[model samples]
Target: MNSFDKLYYENYHKVYRVALKMSGNAQNAMDIVQEVFLSLFDKLENGGEIIYPGTWLYKVTVNKCCDGLRKQMRFATLDVAAGNEFHEVTIEKQETRQIIEKALFELHPRERVIMVLYSEGFSYKEISEASGVKFQSVGKTISRILEKLEKKLKGLNNDLY
Candidate 1:
């Protein structure tokens, strides 16, 4: 197999899992993985070399996920602002996930992506490259986003009262 093929095979699962966790849905995860590979194919076709295939795939996957979330947010915002009610589930764990997802869903796409990538063990520099943000801004954003998440999670716990 060629280098691109080999890299794809080796890192496909890692990228997919990251996508799945980011998306919280299997279908979207599959779509992001496919999109990443398709982008990889185009890069290889154009003779672009991947010195770090794993990192490249992670970035692509994160980009696909952020794009999907942006589209969803647009639709959701319109629906909510139109006074259309959503039928959200109310189970305990599901409620917790919803609260977390709601806060995550409210963040700027890049911030949300960075938080997830950071949680998955990527350093600030890695997150900056993956999320296409300035490297210098990563630390500030990570600190701010974590503070916001903590506050939101605490608010969620209170809401359960």
Candidate 2:
């Protein structure tokens, strides 16, 4: 297989999933995945160096997702607009999802990206590489971010029910 094909085979699934979780929607995730691969192909054709394919893919994915979120914040989010889609789920689970979505939307794009990466089980080093945050800061930053999520969730729960 060609190098681009090989890279696509190895990383496409992961890139799509990371985009999905980060954007909280299928369409946006797919768009980001497409853009990422297209950019990668362009870079490859232009003879740009790619020392670490996985890291580069993830970092680009994160940046694309962050850009989408920032633009989304300027308008509104898919989660907010699509709230009725969750009506078929159990109320408890739906409520939990709503609270989590609220918390995620409240976070700055950087924090949201880091939290998504952490939730996807990426190590601190991987998250730092993807996010450009310091490796030493990932733990402390994530700790604080989780605490913020928890606090927001608790507040949402109390306010809602």
Using TM-score as the measure, which candidate wins?
A: 2
Pairs that collide in candidate 2 are none
Candidate 1 structure quality by residue, lDDT tens digits, 64-158: 88788877874133111111233454455565666677777667777778878887898878888788879999888888998998887787688
Lowest lDDT sum, 10 consecutive residues, model 1, at 75-84
- Angstrom error of the Cα, residue 38, model 2: value is 0.7
Worst 10 residues of 2 by lDDT: 74-83
- With a 3 Å backbone cut-off (N, CA, C), the pairs that clash in candidate 1 are none
In model 1, the number of clashes is: 0
Error of 2 at 23 (Å): 1.5
What C-alpha lDDT values do all the predictions have?
Answer: 0.77, 0.86
